[model samples]
Target: MTKFPVLHEEQVREFYYNVEFVEDDSLHTWVGNKSLYLDEELLEKILELPDMHCAGVQKKIMKGEYQLLFEFVNKVLLPRTEKHIMASSTDLFVMESLCKFEPLNLLALVLEHMYKTVIEHKGKHRMG
Candidate 1:
């Protein structure tokens, strides 16, 4: 799993795309010299998970809405103990991902974020 997400900064206005860069004002998340973009395809994979897998907190998953699903994805797939507080969530792209059934490739996105965290904070005490 990717260690740190490509978050959008509601605080920083200087950067284009409102993208949060990690450490030293440098873009820590990158692929081929360009910054890494966030992916919502994780949502697609989550949608397909068996109802049994999703029955953890809720008795059953409600398909029409994805907020619960997104939180579940974060908890299980992306893996965070924090439940319900989306962190850096977006809805439109997730809806777009949910609307489509085509196969999604999450490998590269996963790699970049993982690599970014490793390269940026390889030592010392803090982690993202």
Candidate 2:
């Protein structure tokens, strides 16, 4: 399991203040005149799916070998309803995009996930 650091209040403030919306909504920071955008390192660590850079990923997807990809997206990325047994459009998109080595906007990822979660439980509200 990949561990995310617990951001303190100050850290969140620093990030909000320092962050920039660069290309395609990707988060960036300009430090010492250097523009920095985190790439696939974080996602790769999260997945730990071996042979990602190999030439066979697209082939596997094409063959409908979705078990591996589905596991990562459903279990690791979004631990929602266990009934999420098969990959949704969003899950497939992540697999396809990341497989193609496309740039990832981490901020967009978080926002999209939050939006989906809210949508999924839109009317199931319960007061404590």
Candidate 3:
């Protein structure tokens, strides 16, 4: 279980807008699911970890302190993702590429999730 850092709207937009194309497709599909991209239950578990705390992660990404992002990507996000994608497939290269895509996809996933989360949370708060 691992918790992702809180990202601002501007940062999410920046990351989404700056994405590179993989062939004709926008590589956007690599990061899908606005709600619970990296296992919401697991994310919740990670968040509850005593050692964890929220940080302004997007700023660090913009500043190119990718190690922090990499840690979360490699250790927490990628492994779980790989298990699903690589389960039936045997191609190491594709698996490797997918693993690489994990971090970038993570950014995409987080941004999309954040956007949806804000909208949903606000909707609930306002309605309730």
Candidate 4:
């Protein structure tokens, strides 16, 4: 079984607060005006991959593999969404923009949020 990473909440909060969003008119419009949410099924699929544990995932993101990461994100996470479809051809472009501008900051934010979300869901199920 794959385990989600246990990120330090304080560090994650600091990163979340400090990360800057660069102005990109194209990507901004492509992503739409809503907050990006990861798909549960995509998260599960990633967790199931033998080589896709938390540390490895983080390493890949930090190593500038945003294209691959977003490939999975677009295919499994955001597929079928209007925003995703609209930006399908421009996935690489947007990812490059994010990598060049935000670096690993955005990835860290997403991973931190995803980990907390999974934990909260598991807790709810156990309690229910």
Candidate 5:
């Protein structure tokens, strides 16, 4: 059994907000002409999971490892969102109330928002 890292909402927020973009000369010819890198410490911590072993998680991020992270975020956030929707009287109230409790739920919202932003950005930069 693999033990995944337990992430707090603050950590997730920090990770997304702190993303560093750099110029990759190799990718200069690519559509966006830019590259993004995550904090190495975050990657190391996540890779510590028993089932995960990689020479470099950052490299894998560009190769689609990020979808794995998104999946984890969804796994954490979806249940809570569902619970709130089922119990709350108003949809607006549920969203507003999401931030009142554990940070994990808030982190889920942030992750979902970021994921959508990335998809939109990628689509705008597509080679087509």
Candidate 6:
């Protein structure tokens, strides 16, 4: 069996295409651009995850969207617990550990800020 659980190819494609890197402010934003150098066939077969940002959590922290942050934590940080355990309680606790404790410690605090921003602006149509 593969060490990492399989994720949908479409989901992985979306993640990569949606990821954006803002050049001016040094803040990498997910602009949902599909203009990358990845091969279509390869992208169709593999799942790519988001990288964490090292910048401060001011973006997520000031917005009071700790729950949203937690969700990201679950998605990015709880892979180990998710892979081995089937219990909801343990999974939930592992999810909580993103904030207080960590076993893998692979979670990136930087990209999380961008995640919070994207989620907050999800439904609105910004014309700029």
Q: What TM-score goes with each of the models?
A: 0.32, 0.41, 0.19, 0.20, 0.21, 0.19
Candidate 1, poorest ten consecutive residues by summed lDDT? 50-59
- Ranking the candidates on lDDT from highest down gives 2, 1, 6, 4, 3, 5
- Superposed Cα RMSD, model 2: 10.2
Show model 5 residue runs off by greater than 4 Å: 1-104, 123-128
Better of 1 and 4 by lDDT: 1
Q: Give the clash count for each candidate.
A: 0, 0, 0, 0, 0, 3
Measured by lDDT, the strongest candidate is 2
The sequence of per-residue lDDT tens digits that candidate 3 reaches over residues 9-116 is: 654544444343333322331223342223333444555432111122222333233444444444464333222211212122223345566312233344334443
lDDT of 5 by residue, 10-79 (tens): 5444444444333321111121333344332333454442211101223223324334433343345333
Question: Which residue runs does candidate 3 get wrong by more than 4 Å?
Answer: 1-103, 125-128
lDDT of 2: 0.52
Compute the lDDT of residue 77 as modeled in candidate 2: 76
Pick the winner on TM-score between candidates 1 and 4: 1
Model 6 per-residue lDDT tens digits across residues 5-109: 777876554654365544332332233553443332333345343222211232233334555655564466543322321223333444445556644212333
For 4-114, candidate 4 gives per-residue lDDT tens digits of: 988786554443333333332111111223333333344445554221111122323333456465766567643432333223323443355555663332333344444
Candidate with top TM-score is 2
lDDT of 1 by residue, 53-109 (tens): 101333134354565656555566555333444333222233334557533334333
Candidate 3 lDDT score relative to the true structure: 0.36
Supply candidate 1's per-residue lDDT for 14: 23
Error of 4 at 20 (Å): 35
**Candidate 1, 24: how far from true, in Å?**
16
* 41: Cα error in model 5, Å: 16
Give candidate 2 regions above 4 Å deviation. Answer: 1-65, 122-128
Q: How many pairs of residues in model 5 come into backbone collision?
A: 0
